[model samples]
Target chain A: MSIPLALASGTGRFYKHSAKIIRFARHGCTNRPFFHIVVMERRKAQHQPVIEQLGTYDPFPNEHEEHLVAFNFERIRYWLGNGAHLSTPVAELLGIAGLLPIHPRTYMTAWRNRRAAEEAAAKASESGADANKAPESKEGGSGTS
Target chain B: MSFGSNLRMFANKASLCCNVNKVTLELFSRCSTVAFLQYDKDPGPSFSNPDVQKLLKSMTRVQLEKVYKKRSVSDNTVEYKFMTSEQLEKQFRKAAERAEKLIQMPPIVKVKEDSQKVISRDPALTNFSNTKFVIADITYGVNSSDRKILVRQTDGTLEYAPLSIRKRINQIYFPHPGRKIRLPRMFEPEHLNRCLANFQYEFILDRACVQFDPYEKEYHEITTKVYNHINESKRFDDLRSTRHFGPMAFYFAWHQIIDDLLYDMIKQDYLKNGAELVALYYQLNGIDYDKSIHEKLETLVQPQSTIQSVLKPKASDDMHEEIKNAIGKSAEDFTADDISFEFIETFVKTKALKKVQLELALQALRETNDEKKKLYHGLKKAHGIS
Candidate 1:
């Protein structure tokens, strides 16, 4: 049997060696809900120690509304360039902030409903036209002008 | 009481009257009786000298009356015009009627028991009815204990008598320039006349010690307000239980209940006037507080919080279970990006983790990576690691 691609790469046959990069994660809480962006190893436990805390997102309306989200965009961009994966919620929040492309999974429920409605309308129009043609053809044999 | 001593006393009175006001001095120098007396070659006449005795003795009653009428020299330039016996009687009567109308007299105020020395008991002349003087004509002896009330004489000497002397002899107008006499604590005037004296004067509360009656309507009003407030609030019940600490101490102890805004207002008022808060607490339902009892009251009143409640040396199994559940949920709740030191500290504290267990947990989370070592050190530093 052929060796697995991951093992081949580790064996230095197919791909060059790659360094392990720590991923950024988000922790969220309510009661003056705030989000923390923390850097950590992928292999480590979610609650394990972090390499660094990038910034915070406070969605709650505090004394000022404009200060809802605060982040080191330069650091976030650096990490993103370094192939750091964003947590699902973090990706969605960033998408809403216009900082990144809209996350594919962010509005799944709304998108699904819109698609279903469009399909239903097209089917209804087709069925109505077919019913009209069938009746006209059947009646033309009986009442040809 | 001898003639020489009496002459010396009259000299001292003359010197005092001369020293009092320029207006009175000019009047006395111009007076026909004093003009006849030979004055020593001094800046002011040396009435204190023995030579003035002959002139003083030879002075007629009518001439003496003229000096007395013009002798009024208060701290202010208060002048008293000479009046005939009929005019003096009418003026004294008018003053008595005015006092009766203005002063809120207690229907029957007790003449203080100890005032017998100063308040002569000869009812006919010394009774309250006859004992009326024009306030302007009355000059006080500065020494409170002496209880000497002097009326200025026409010759610029003082007559030591109660106000009734004016009713007794119309021709004798006594005025002197001795220091203004405060109202005696023993003499309870029926009238509350603000115009009679300065309201800023503080009366001695101890009636036995002072000659003027201390049971003034204004003083009575303040003391009553404080007493009533203490009675109603019952906030000072503990302080009152001690009995040694007076109502003032009790009022001071109740400061904790006062809110910040009210306390600020009270503080401002207090700085403006020392007894503003004291008066305010009595008048309004404002809180009275003294900072001295803050720590004691805090210990006595506040309930212990959760962290303070965690006192056991040994960790309970239930506590461990709760902490493990909380940590597990917190770990699962987030995608691996966020780890909070504060949350971990709180969780460990809630478990009532032993010092050894805390050390073990901290060691488990300690970073080994070279690049992240600085961050790990920072976290530890925040947790108070040197």
Candidate 2:
């Protein structure tokens, strides 16, 4: 006779479909710690054994040297297809890596440009009325001109 | 007889100086007696008369002022005051030197031909280091519309800027130029300090204009020029690198750019009319509308007196009831606008609510408005509650 298999009975987390893509801190020989992009149960601790280690991120590598961030793109795409939500920093990293579409949060220069454009538009509309008045007054050389 | 006897006795007592030389001794005794009386603490027999004492007391203040002539006696000691002619002479000489160093500018409106002589290498201007030469004989060219503001740059070149730029800067610091920053009454230290303050403001404005002409299309070009100029010029570099002025360089740059950005908005006719757009602007900028600006905008829009007429009745009772109902209502039911938040803020502030009362009011009102959640949070933060 076969025993009935129960989901979440072993992990202590109730319900099915709990997955998170997180940056897990991993201590290295160097003074600074690096990160591991992993697929894990939502309830599991960061240092707990990950379901699958998909990538590595070395943020504090030697000066003038490019830091390494490598990942299994196929596994990432597969997990992403399975409705795995990307954390903000992880999404930013993935966006930079070209594995995912560009994240809006990471595009600060675009946001600044948009803001400057909006401001210019607002200023133009505002000054449109008074612009004629100022030039007129200046030309007239009226009181205190 | 008593007065005569007292005078004779005093004269005989002071007669020791007569032993030196008859004529010289006589003059010395007279002068010494007067000086002695001026510096003396105790009343001598000659000064014992009530009438004499009263007369001396009345005339002493006036006499003391003129008696010094060019000499200044320092009251360094508590009990005894002693100063020789040599010491007085030395003090007088130092004072003259100081007066000479402090170049007194003629009336700001008047153009003085002799100013050129006074401007060149004055001892007083030695303290200003580089700025002294520029400001010393600076000419003001007041034309029909636009006047040229000229000041000597660090590189011994006269840098020219527009009057409009100076006026804008003056408006920034001294909002009401006509009333405040009045012409100096006299060229004193305080006046000199005011001039220095103006110099700093003008210097910053001048540099900002050089760096970025807000109206011009060549923004990067102007900025690059300004950056290069500041770095290359010795005086500019000195100013930028100095501990005190280094931070102010950033401030000056930001001020110019921000002013350029805001100038169009502030000068708008629509904004000058009412508080609605001004309020929107403030909300956008995350700054509260200044009371003066608010009042000015209100007056410009309405063209009416701020005071409410006594004859006109107010709907304050209904307003109070509405506010009470708003306070009692749930967050989903009640909608709070900017005006409501402003009202609540003013209410809390005007009532001078206690810490506990303010917290209670905020807590009660927090549920009333979803839109003003950020504002309420700001209010809560201001009250020092997490």
Candidate 3:
């Protein structure tokens, strides 16, 4: 008989169709933890778990960094696909990790940077055009003479 | 004139200053004791008569000098600065020019009319009441003919107007029409309230933490204690009764955390939904609740132990080092946004998270990058960016 299994903080629930594993990664600052949950296969080991990453779970850590923890991502996705239910928080974490395939035009730091660069380039070209125009106007007058 | 006549004229002038009251003169004559009083060895005799004492008191050295100076000045020839005839004529001409300018100006006629008159004349003037229209200073004349009132405003501008009897009555009786006026709002109160609730909900969801208080009479308390015991061996401070460690403090701590969360949210999206929350909270609960209770709630719920541990310089040093390694730069090199600055200040001051100072510094560097990008875009727009 298959037994019910929940990983990480028990935020995952198992349903008849699939089991969802909420995986989180504590990656940012030492005491500041950021979590992401990923659904993976329950049969696999913790590190080499074969499944798609589902989501993240991050509990803000204390100063000593003793309680910092992270969850396996690949196994979480595998479980989610098979039939695993996620809680609200787990679902949100997964959405942020891009495992759920959200809106393509989501606001991201990289997009902002790209737009800023394009604007900067446009400004430089406009000024360049202005500078060139002044010289060209003077040349036109000289040619007329 | 004879020398005796001239001496008599001088004596008459001198006597004018020393003349006593007629009654006193008569009393002096009747009283042969006046000589004894005058020659009395004691000055006390003069004090017996209040009039004599008053005269003697008034004749001080300063008073005498003032009198002599007044006489001397009156007797001397006085000099005056007299203007020449041409100078007088020029001054008179300027005065005449100014007077002519003043006379040429029209008289101020206060239009003691009601709002009805003004409304009938100009519908736009209905915006105001108790209208006392001042006929312009250059108005040559004012007359009402065929229900039309003619007015010449200052600067030689003439206006043909109609009488507004309704406005005139309004001005004379009910001058204030504030009861009928209605104003438009940019955002409805209900809409604003909903927006605030949404922001508050998101903020709470993002930052709210559930911790097991050892003092709580629940199984969670025992589990938390066991967890703490297994995690570390440091002596924990018993903050059961402390004002900064209890439920109230926890509430306030959570409030501050949520405030920071909202700040981060707005920075990411530029939607001041948090401001709407604050406004709605005030509107529903009043300023007292927002300023006192809400503010206190944030302080009460804060995790003082974690803050205290983080703020400790020795404890924070290692954390700072780790942060530096992660970011690959010094925290001092970072520049933060206004919201981040406020968050850092509040978090450090209340929670005493000394390590956060380094985090703030790193965040500041990222903020600088953001600002530079924003500035570059702004400049590009000014240059007509495509």
Candidate 4:
């Protein structure tokens, strides 16, 4: 049987081609709502699906802890193999979560290191300037005989 | 009867009604004018006049007596009460007994062993030539029981030794020129702002990576289009061109890419889990990725996405249209590279579509130029045939 590219139910919707899913829990924490995306098998039930846990997506803070929607990645891959699809939003989320690569280049670590170095250099320069100013003011007051 | 005699009778009556104590009566007699005067003005005579009757009722007899005596009425029956000889003798005996008990009582003031008074005078003059002020030396005797610094003010009155004075005097006397007040190193606003901006870029880049799923085959086409658009704009070049490799440029470049990706996601519903996708964006951006931030972003994007989904509006809706129109009108003044379609799009979306319409109209003008060339070539070929 051909795998459906996308599937939608009360929990959320998933797009097979994109390998993403958007899961919105109807009831869990108090009155506040929650949503999540889990990669799972096409044939498996969303809540009981076999997959890897990636992360959680919570909407309301007033609710209990369980209202949060969590994702397992291994389970998601299993579902993807079984022909599960992800929705567009879920696909983007996966990309942001680092499950998928969105940008052509990754400069996260390099950028952080560069920034730290710049901050250190700036701090050093500022301290040096302050040190130089103190002596200059002292020298101005005292002229050689 | 004379007003003085009348006042005296009134005082006796007032004393009987109020149950005044002996001491209180004596005090009142000494202070009140009525005690020295007698008053026998028959209130019955005053009763005939309504005003006098009202005044009499309002002003108690004792009060009236006082008023009459104060006016110097001489006929006074009130005699000042004095202690009799026997009563004086009894009071004297009681006083003697109280004095005896006081003398007999054991000493109530106990001398503590550790009680020592310390006199701290300002060291006649501060010696600030070379010594540094030690906080420990000043604060040492402040809370101790043995050390008491009696501070005599200029007026010779002793003021409790001020603890702060000791510290101030010590500092002035022993000045530390090299004593630096070290403050915590803080991030400069500009630098921090730049860092935050760079962090935002990284975050955006991370979000783009997730959204586009650069590794995925299906996302390959969309990623290429976005990359091409970014490269064409030389947006990344601006980031690299800076002499300083501060993450700010990278951050801004990433921000642009993420915005494009988010725009795509919103339009296409590319990410199945929109909230999670946004959360990831926040995480990579170095944002707290807390529930509130997600909720806020959700509120902003969700409605926009809903509108886009139903209307299927072009990506131009995401751009501010006002800036686009401004650029279009002034296009002659700007270089081709300076014109940002993305900025124009943002302006059009935020301001109005008129500018975008104008931009399209300008493009049509370019198209017409191409048409003229085609026609010219055709006419030349026809002339050659003839």
Candidate 5:
């Protein structure tokens, strides 16, 4: 005798013209992260079975340090044309692919990171000068001596 | 309708009690000074060098049962297989391959900090959305670490998202079990010391490794805190034989506080391991040690580090001596205790350690080695074997 399991799967039932969203379904073991981008009914939970898998997003860096993503642009464009709403993450990906404008937050991060790096560099040089007079201070002035 | 309201009240009461438990289960952390990497200098990158990595892996002393303990398998299906002797051997080989994969500890790199890069400032797109939109490049074939993530702010700035937001985006798509979208209660400043006080070193280290990227600042803070506590308490063996030992040992060595650890290693009769520790110290400080002894250390250390085999091209290159002053800058702090004059002619006779730097390294190895040798022979002699 066989019993049906309740694991998340596509039910193979959907209204033909219903709204959908392309997004990720989490997969992989604890501490090991992987994702499958799928087109599913807009109202369903993320783990719900989807109409089709469009791509995968692997957040862990490969040895080459690339966050690999695999998606069918044709299928993605088709879904978009058919009035499927794009999730923020999906929109971000498309932006990176030259399909849309670069996300504004990416610009913000680049600037923030740039500022942090500059501040660190400046601190390093100042600390180098401080090192010149450190021997006199002798193990730093700490505690009420 | 009354029954529904009653259920809602019960739920509300249950949630309130849970919040109370959370609030009372934790307290604020003391702003205890960090001992490891306290000088605004990185203590971990020292481990990236092959030699310290080798020593760390050896010190960790991997025991398969502890490292590869069974997980709660989600799959309930069970299949039985009949196999010939040869087939069973192949199965064992496959299992061993998986074991090798399990012990690969996370790498320690300086947190990746980059300068601000402005892509564009389109005020026209201002007020496009009140909420921020995080965009991740899902281009197939890019490594996750290198994959660029961008975000759009409410003020019409389309630039790179900060590391915090990027980590959130990563977790949204690829969630790690037990990792929360927001900071876990244990990681809050008030709760951190409470967890550390329980000496939950292994659990804290393991969770942090999974929850944060190795290069993230939070990861370093948590790891360094644990290492410092272990050092302060003289409980150096707490992280031993686990993946945590790699970074912890490197932290001690880089910070030049290996005196206590060296004493322990020597006293434990892990002389070869002690020698490797010395080698690590010398390498970090550019101490001119005997090259042949270095080779001996290489032979002594079994290559159990499956993760580092590829990252170790700088075996003999100590060209970074200028910045390596942090190591070995302080005088030896541990005493040369219980090592009889007898060792000067035998173990320390190898001249493997420099007289100036090593009065500390050779402190207790000979005594322990003799003790173990005598014990081994006594067992043999009791059976009438010469």
Candidate 6:
């Protein structure tokens, strides 16, 4: 077997006091959901004691047809200035929040959804056109054409 | 003999209420909770008038004992004081002032307008995200209410965040105790009715005031439903002397359903508060009342006597004797206040929806007052109070 690129020393490879990361901690009940935006040690599992809570996010839409997210950007800037990394979901959220550049995954998902919707529309129109032609022929209006 | 008959009537009424409660409980979740007290003309300007403010304040009938009741302190800053008489008096005055601020009523007004107005649009920004982004400004020194919450939509329109989203974001940044991002399950109609049936009006209204702003539809829906239950159960006493009493009074006056509340007031010998209730109805509806009648009710309050003072000379720890003294004192106090009786009589004649019901209750009150007065006089004669 090919050797792994990195050494297998657990303590050396992953330092005890690794870089800090901004991430989500799962909250809320089944079927219902919520998240807390937290700053924590990079090697720490979720729900472990965190460095700080930067914000919260509600994935579901409210009565206003909007996803609600709250970020203490002042703290966010402080953590980032001190070199805290961001998880992919946090990065995506901040991208839409207009704090960071838009994430590439967001664009990719949007494109895929759009493509699927357009394909559905095209198929519907093609079938609709065939139905129209058949009905016209059965109605005996061929002379007018 | 009259007291025995009264107890029987009370029992029948209690059973009637239980039957109604059973029916309501058996019913499944009804359609959407309908909003109540939707004034076409904005109640805002009217509520701001000083007269209206005074009426609401007096109607609240704050009891210092309840307001300053000891509860667990949320923080570790609890203080104990040992002060001289003067210092203690000063401290109490300061506490009363703080209590005034705490019980200040939330504004009653028309529904709030939509805040999610489009600001700008960019087709290029479309397709980058599938839902609106809610961004809050966390800059220090900004008041929570005035903080900027903006939304960038998936379809490339940037707009100000709506009230719901703004409220949520604020609650997250500065979370209120006993409030959550999602409405607590207890507020659902089925559960709320159960709580209401248990006469938990004060708790529900208190939580609602914390959870919702006055002008929101949910706020109106919840409070009005609670008020309806209170009216149905005739449990106005459960809210008395608490901050909710004023708003409940206001709701009754607004909806023209003051007969039950007024009846309760008359039975409890709070005729002055009852007059104030009628006066509030007139004020809210902008009715032109005779000034003389208003002055009459004002003069009536001067002779207001407490049951405690009349019994003070012969005060005993015996519960039965205390109740007898209360009955005698209430009879004397009731007959002495003719001005309030007259004003309330005029209200019953002209305004109350169920006039005969109120009339019979009024007659009953008068008859009971007369009997008690006779009994008290007989007792005095037997003792030979020359």
Leading candidate by TM-score: 6
The residue-by-residue lDDT of candidate 4 on B101-191, one tens digit each, is 3222111111122223333322211211111111111222233322322333221122343443332333333443432122112123354
Worst 10 residues of 6 chain B by lDDT: B25-34
lDDT of 2 by residue, B1-386 (tens): 11122122145655655456554543343323121211122222323334323222221112111222332336634445467966755655554444323211110011111111121221211111122111111112323123322332222233332333343333332244232232224223354345444444223323333333333223222232332233223133223212223222222221111121112222221112112332322332334545454444333333222111111243455533344343433222223233333533443344221334543545444444453455544554555655
Q: Per-residue lDDT of B1-386 in model 5, one digit per residue for the tens? A: 11122111224444544554432312101112332243234545675767667667777766655665554557646569999967866765665567656667678777766556556676544444334445565444555566666655545566776677667656665566777878777887678898888888888888898778877878877888787787667676777767777777776655545655656666554555565666666676555766465454344344445333323344443423212232211111111122222232243444322343345545444455455455555554554544
Off by over 4 Å in 5: A1-145, B1-46, B68-97, B137-143, B146-148, B297-386
Which candidate should be chosen as best, given lDDT against the real structure?
6
Please, what are the lDDT tens digits per residue for candidate 1 over residues B356-382?
454344344433222244544455455
Worst 10 residues of 5 chain B by lDDT: B328-337
DockQ, prediction 5: 0.04
DockQ of each: 0.00, 0.00, 0.00, 0.00, 0.04, 0.35
> Where does model 3 exceed 4 Å of error?
A1-145, B1-219, B222-337, B346-351, B355-386
Question: What stretches of model 6 exceed 4 Å from their correct place?
Answer: A1-145, B1-37, B68-102, B292-336, B367-386
The ten-residue window of minimal lDDT in model 4 chain A covers: A61-70
**Candidate 6, residues B171-286: lDDT per residue as tens digits?**
97778777888998889989998898788887888889888888888887788788877877888877775767777777677655677898888887776677778888888777
lDDT, candidate 6, equals: 0.69
Interface RMSD of 6: 2.2
lDDT of 3 by residue, B1-386 (tens): 11112111223433553487654443332222111111112222322334322222211111111222222223566446689966755655554444323222111112222222221232222212122222211111222122223232211122433233222322322333321111112123454235333333211211112111122222222222222221122111222111112221122121222233233323433122222233222332223323342233233332222223223343344544544444433323232233334443443444332345434543664566566556554554555642
Better of 4 and 6 by DockQ: 6
Question: Each candidate's chain A: what TM-score?
Answer: 0.48, 0.58, 0.30, 0.35, 0.75, 0.76
Model 4 Cα shift for residue B132 (angstroms)? 46
Q: After superposition, how far is residue A142 of candidate 2 from its true place, in Å?
A: 44
lDDT of 6 by residue, A1-145 (tens): 2212221111223334579888987777687778878887788877665667777788897776668787878889998998889999999888777678768876776667666666666666667668776533332321120
Model 3 interface CAPRI class: incorrect
